[model samples]
Target: MPGHGSNTESMETASAIVSLITASVAIWKTIDAAICSIKNAPARIQHWRAINRLLQTSLSRMEETMKRRKGAGLSISERKHYESIREHLQCFKDDLEDLQHKIASVALPRRFGKRTIPRQVLTALEIKLQEDPHLEKRVDRNIQLFQLSVALLSLLDPAPRTSVRPILTELHALHLQVSDDDDKLRKWKESAHDIAKDAAMREIGFTSSATDRVRVGRQPSINIQPTPQRDFGIDENFNKEELLHKIKVTQDLATRLEEAGMPTIASNFQLDAIKCGEQLREMHDHPLDMAEYVSLEERYILILISCQSYEEASFQIALNRLNDLASKVDDTSRNELFRERQTIGTLYAKLQDINSAIHFLRIALFDGYLKQQDLLAYDAEIRQTSRLLYEVYECSGMWPDLEVTKKRVRDEFGEDPVASSVEISKALGWCEKKGFTVSERDRQLYFNPLTNENGRTSLHEAALDPKMDMDVLRYLMLPEYYSLRDDSGDTALLLAADRSNYNVVEMLLTIPYLVHVRDRIRRQTPLHRCKDKRTLDLLIEAATRRNSIPPGTDWEPVDINSADCSQRTALHLACQQGRVDLVETLVAHNANVNATCLTGETPLVLACWAADTAKPALEAIVRELVSHGATWEQKFPVRRDPRKRLKARGFSNSDISELTRQPGSSTESSEVEKDASILMHLDS
Candidate 1:
């Protein structure tokens, strides 16, 4: 009897196994036919086909196993899997039917305007397919059409809406529908809740551009940003090639992470991302922008700062660090290299902290760097800093402060006013690069009320400051301002040339009319105020070129020998100041070697008369002058013993000379005799 009973159970289990395998095959055939009918689907629909194909593989594997084991009594696991499969097939029976019916319409003739079906059911099927092996355990055999709809809707939402909201809505609807008594409703609703949010988020991952509205979820584990491009704005201050390289490396890491499965960018890509992040942090802390490697360390310590807040914390931190830097330099000097302070200040301005921006701007204007700079190179620190300062003030409606900032610029350019009281920065140059234009507000702020409270024009204010932002200057600069001199009789060229602003000098020299523009005091020309050798060379070269002046126009190049009010020529000033380079440059350019000042001192004599402290430079200038045919022969007496008359002529004797006599032979004696003869004649 026991053997017979066991045999009956075995037969029944075999029948059940065969029936489950048949049911799985039947549904898989339905899905396979639907997939075959849908031809050349769009990417969105193709995934539906792919999931169905994978499902067919799972079903085929199951059927083949059942066939091999047909008539064998079911093992514990096998019976469980057999029941699970039967339940899974029953749960999705309607979904498979719906897909089978809809897919033929998708495959309809093109002439019939090709029909389509909803992808929600396909997506839900795909989601369940990915969770295989355990599918039977979780498959709710009594799943209703509404439960399928809820799950399909969750997976369909590209934004996924929110993980909690949709799940809550489904749960609430299920609660009202079942009165909390329907266990199958409860069972399937829990199952939907488990997979819906995650499934929706995964759907979003497939669409990286989707907003990923899963509010409480982690940062979308996928990169949604499109590839970085090379198009850059003026805001980029770092090396562009390096920036691009950094971005590319980052992108490569993201690609690797995505290629592997990820919770965080998986496997080696996670490592790469971590290392890259570490490298970025290291770079953020210590920027290494060395070309030759000689100036590597400490070059870019504070050039950039990242801020999360717009309030004073960041600004204050930056300033304190800057002060710490200055303290390292000197406990009391209270200065950083201008580039450092300017970066922090510019960042403050970007963050819209006006006062902090102004404060940093003020701190950045250390007289050390600016005092040494004449004509700045393109993109010089001072130029950028000043531009930022002007923008900050103007944007903040601090016109008075903006105007006051124009004075801070005054500190940047100072050549010697020892010979003339003209402010070097106030005398600036402006011409244009071809086809450049500035807005009207830029013109007013940069170039505006014609003249300041002092008689200096907007052009004067523009001169040293643009630092060679030539495009705007091209628009702002016009011929009217060329001849407009301030009360001090300074032209922009005179200012630029005076500052030895090479770029300004080079640009201003482009306009033929500006080469010889002179200042009122001492009647000195740009040539007279030019203290830099390169600038002097440029001026001399420009003077030699033909002035595009019309044949009858009174335009004439200022004579290389034109004298100032002191009767001092450019060469005379060069020699007098013991500027060996300037004197060499001038002499080489054919400046009159024997040009005399109001006191009748020749270039050789003036050079020889340079202070004993300037003995070496004086010797060099004397040699340069003499080599260019300067003579010691003085036709006039020592006009009031030059040194004695210096103090009375608004000159400082201490600054000019500590007179020293030189030992000489007969040639010098004869010169002394002539000097005595002139003195005797003056006495008579």
Candidate 2:
């Protein structure tokens, strides 16, 4: 009985604290809601700053409370409640930080602060609030937790008149305010719903009457009577009309939000509308004609894609509905049926069901051709399907099947033989190099394509495979082929480098002219992409062919520390990718481990920040950098404590030439100085 009494007392105290915290959070949320609706730009920002200040105060208060309660003989539940409160406070603080950043970016007009926050920014904030459920959910949680805590406290505290009165009063006030807001929202939603429904009905009625003639005949009707209502776990008070109205209002709101640069918020509202629409369609007594039902299913698919709602259950439902609709269409409408199948395939692909995806896409091609006499007529459709299938094969690493698809696609679309022939030859060479069976048709084409504008030549594709054969590559060894740059300016060597295909890199290195070639878009060389030790070594060896310079010829070797458009060196990439072996190899080859990217992220900083970097591996890499004379004290001078060290010290933006200064000045020293000057200007 004594232990029971003590437990009761503990719970009561916890409940009181929870209730107080809940009331405070609700007030915070109320202010946030007001800020969301504020029209004046400067006033809204001022309110956000005030709210941010409040959050910081709340966070500090919670931290102090936590420290005071460290050994305060609290129950497990009480401790948990305290921890939850602290977490919610911190989350609010973080969200406010983001909100402040978003607000700061919008330019306010020179006119007096009388103008409403730019219409666009207001709309964006509205959408942001709608899309992110965290604000609403957090408030709701706080209310529930506080209410529960208050109840517990009331049970334990006998002197409730003094101990619980203020807490109860605050909580009641918050509850009333929240309920009032809900009522206003519901009323607005209902009005919007009615207007949308009227407009939609008028349009649908006109379209239906014009396109379809009613047949006067005796209709077969089922005499089935209604049984008990099917629950489907839906709310008993759920109104069909209300849901319809909400869907319309939410969709319109989302569209406006999206147009105003609040895609995330818009997406959330669209998702909400879709969920409502789905429920409306699934109601047992809902009246939808077959065509209308099919259209609704298609709409669901579109909305899901719009919202990026890639959850498997939603996709599965859409796929099932599409399949059901496809089953009803006759052979005369096989094109429609093909589209449904293709949609199903694409959805399956998104779900990572590769076999099912391939099966459905193949069915689309076959059924459209066989049933609708659509073979060459739908060649474009088939080609598109083939492209998706090829991507799936490549992603799933079904290399043989990828080769087969390539051959089949080129052969089937015979209208463009010249282009298809070149593609087929290239594909064949890649397949031969990778030891995937090359089609017999491809063997006849002896020469490679003259130009690779689209970036899919045989050598480039083959170089992506780690096991590419020397014999297959011999066919592409002509001087022109060896030196060829694709549309992206990527040579075979660059492709090999990016993939860490060691064997392929070794073979490609035979072509001396390809060693230092950079891609067109990023201007990244083979070294920039290489993250494997052996592949990097091969690239470094090719770049540093001192013997090729011929004694005292005065030609400098290639710059191993060459930077890409982003100023990222091979060391930066290696460190970023957590490639310890490559990192070591690159440093050994005189790669600048201290090199800073455009963002001022050094190799040490990158290695530390890499999401996948293992603790032991990171330690080893950091140790390697330190051994090679990296001094974080000069660049990232932070406190000795590990936790303090891990806190993001802002960008170093150190002098680049000094950061990457070599022991011996090279011919490219001028370029480094230019880069350093540009960086300084940018920094200033």
Q: lDDT per residue, candidate 2, 1-684, as tens digits?
A: 324433343344444444555555555564455466555456424434333332423333433343333323333333344434434444444554555445445455565365454553564455556667455444333333333233322222212212122222223223333333444333322332222222222232311221112223211111123245555734244677787777677777665643432233344566666567667767778633344444444444544433221122444554564555455533334445666667667756654567877877777755554345546676666666765665566546577886776666555554322235555566465655544433434433344334343455667767766666554554444344555666666777777788888877776664443575777888787888776766776677567542233233222345678888999887887777878887766665446656777876678777777768776677566656643434353334233321232343322323222333211111222233222222212212
The alpha-carbon lDDT assigned to residue 424 of candidate 2 equals 54
**Model 2 accuracy (lDDT, Cα):** 0.50
Write one digit per residue (lDDT tens) for candidate 1, span 474-561. Answer: 3334545666776776788888888888877665654545775667666788888988977876777566543444343323458578
Task: Give candidate 1's error at residue 168 in angstroms.
Answer: 97
lDDT of each: 0.47, 0.50
Native-vs-model 1 lDDT?
0.47
All models, RMSD in angstroms: 35.9, 25.0
Best by TM-score: 2
